[model samples]
Target chain A: MRVGELSRRSGVPIPTIKYYLREGLLAPGVATAANQADYTEEHVRRLKLIRALIDVGRVSVAGAREVIDALSADGRDPLDLLGEAQYAIAPRHRPGRESPEWPAARERVVALVEARGWLVHPDSDVIDLVADALSAGDRLGVAEFFHNLEGYADAAVQVAAMEVRSVLARPDPAAQMELVVLGTVLGEALFSALRMLAHQHESARQLGFSPPTPADHGVNPAP
Target chain B: MRVGELSRRSGVPIPTIKYYLREGLLAPGVATAANQADYTEEHVRRLKLIRALIDVGRVSVAGAREVIDALSADGRDPLDLLGEAQYAIAPRHRPGRESPEWPAARERVVALVEARGWLVHPDSDVIDLVADALSAGDRLGVAEFFHNLEGYADAAVQVAAMEVRSVLARPDPAAQMELVVLGTVLGEALFSALRMLAHQHESARQLGFSPPTPADHGVNPAP
Candidate 1:
């Protein structure tokens, strides 16, 4: 169909469609004329996935791009595809460079990390991760910080493994897939919000402070 | 004390400390001479916070900078400070442009969201969110994706609220802060990994696939 027809058929607006073309998020329709272009069913499907990632998953464009590329890669079965998608969204220490002087302080932190025996890679990424956190009030000593994080990572690994094992233990295939769909799609957001709440409450307890009020919008307020 | 002494005291190494200084993640120790510099207690504390954020929280250097600045903002209460930190670590979408060529497809997804009466903001962000997801193999015509995500978000909100309420219900401030650290530091990693497993197992069931042998990790060897 022509652009207008494509818009009508797809329910996306014209100007917005133009923007997608510019962003490389969408390819332009076939040129029927100098000013006209045609779209296809594939376009409709693609547009929907993009929307799902952005609107529901709340991933950024760069993040979403990575995810889409992963999905397009071979070896993904339908049942496992969603699971892979979840991995792409999994949280990790985002890495970037810091000022040169930051490394002196970083080494101190790294030693503490090593002494504590946390399973972290000693990459430049670690430097980027630690460089910006220097100013928070609840500053941890090197020993204390590494010890705390290692404990936390260990606890997390155990809990997550248990939950997943339980989910997979069920016998019914339909239920299993439903669980996967439900679990992968919603599980990250659910637990992420939960963790934030847990953190705030726990931090408050350690600091001898009051736990803050919940957002009450059915959404856990950040922190 | 000298920078070397401060490094020993803080557990930060000299080389890494130098990097932190160059990155602005730390202030320069007071220079005693061309070859010597003195450091102070504040440096030690700041180094710890930086380590926690980078090493534990896994924040990027640029992101950590933003987070630290927010945490250090004068006059903000600790609760508010933490809230800001949570959101900063993972910012939510604002809005973005949509495409006209896929109006029908966009509308299908939007309508699915609207039918649920979701309070989605229509803007460039939302548009890009939808557009990028197109590559994820989600069928635009299928309503299941929207329904699934909405349901999941709802459940997540409820679970999170419960967790927070339970923690806050505690009578002691010390206990509350401890919970905060526990949840944030530990809970985030734990739940995320579980969610990933859930996706993998569930997807296999949905696709009529059998589990691999014990020797085989969940991932296919070919993959």
Candidate 2:
């Protein structure tokens, strides 16, 4: 298929596909003739993955490229490649003097890790992210929320264990890589949306606001 | 304090502060002269909140203004205010024909909600978000992960319930609003980071890989 067909098939615009080709984010298609090339199914799949990373994960083009490269690397440990890919696309989090309570927040994170007997790197960027988020909670006057970290950690580890097991069950390395990317990015999205809905339910329950069923509200049944 | 001091105090630029004022996202300072206005500590707090919404939450100026206004509305229900604010900052997700598997995915989400006995509105945008994300998984060849939605829902509800409780416990409506916004945005970040760490631990445990200790790895001790 030509670039036009690839765009039509993948829902990406022709110019954007051309730009990706020019930037070497997408591999060169087979040169069928001068100034024309034939793309295959792999190109369509790659294009979709690229869009997912950039549009959904909000990763920069360069960051997406790096993640793609990491995924494509041969004969490497799956765990390392996945870690690098997940870290590459993760939002950068930095704690500063603005959150004076960050020190206690950091201790809480450390304590949670120790209590959980988890095998995570002591200095991982995620530690700082978790600490910083808790620190921000303190800054915002939700100091009581810190006491619930154990509950959050329990749920996180439970769901994450399930996700990891699914990724490892993939028959091929390529499938495993796809699962890692999707689970890391889209899984967070899935869980966040669920949390939002859950919060809505909890809020309604606490306030005695009955949820209007779709049948009563004339809401569309299909999404 | 003036705009310059507000900038220095909140780490927002003077021009950006003026821009927020011009856009009515931030309340204007008291006029002391034609060219000067006095800002209070409330201005400093409001500036930080604005930055948190824009910078951390990645909310548009217009969206932030709506959320701020909703927060300030007198005699309104906190539950409704929080729902509006969270829904406002949430990333817009529209499922399209490209995700052909969305119908089945939507059914799975409906089933999960029913099974959990959750009281969320049946037609909430989050229902579509969860369906769309799951549909993407189906498109990407990770259909087996859908079977794990129950576990994910379990965790989401557990944490979200705690968060809503914390918000409701706030002594003032203003504090309740702050917790709602902060919990919705930073809480997601916090949980995502925690999930990433949990994935790392699970991967390491499954592969028999030892997590590097900070002391031996020369990792920074402080975040």
Q: What are the TM-scores, per candidate, against the unseen true structure? A: 0.48, 0.89
Error of 2 at B58 (Å): 2.1
The regions of model 1 sitting more than 4 angstroms off are: A1-28, A41-45, A51-76, A83-191, A194-223, B1-31, B34-36, B40-45, B51-78, B96-186, B205-223
lDDT by residue for model 1 over A1-223, one digit each (tens)?
A: 6777767665667786787777766767889888877789767655655655565465566665566665555654443455445545544443223434455546654554345333233442323333433212123422222223333333333434443444455575433433343334434443454345434444344445432333221222345
In the order shown, the candidates' DockQ scores are 0.11, 0.53
Please, what are the lDDT tens digits per residue for candidate 2 over residues B76-156?
A: 866567668877888764545256798888888887777665676677777887887788767665668767787888898
**What fraction of the correct interface contacts does each predicted structure contain?**
0.12, 0.66
- lDDT (C-alpha) at residue A35 in model 2: 94
Task: Compute the interface RMSD for each candidate structure.
Answer: 10.6, 3.0
Who wins the TM-score comparison? 2
Assess each prediction's global lDDT (C-alpha) against the native: 0.48, 0.78
**TM-score computed on alpha carbons, candidate 1:** 0.48
TM-score of 2: 0.89
Kindly report the docking quality category of candidate 1. incorrect
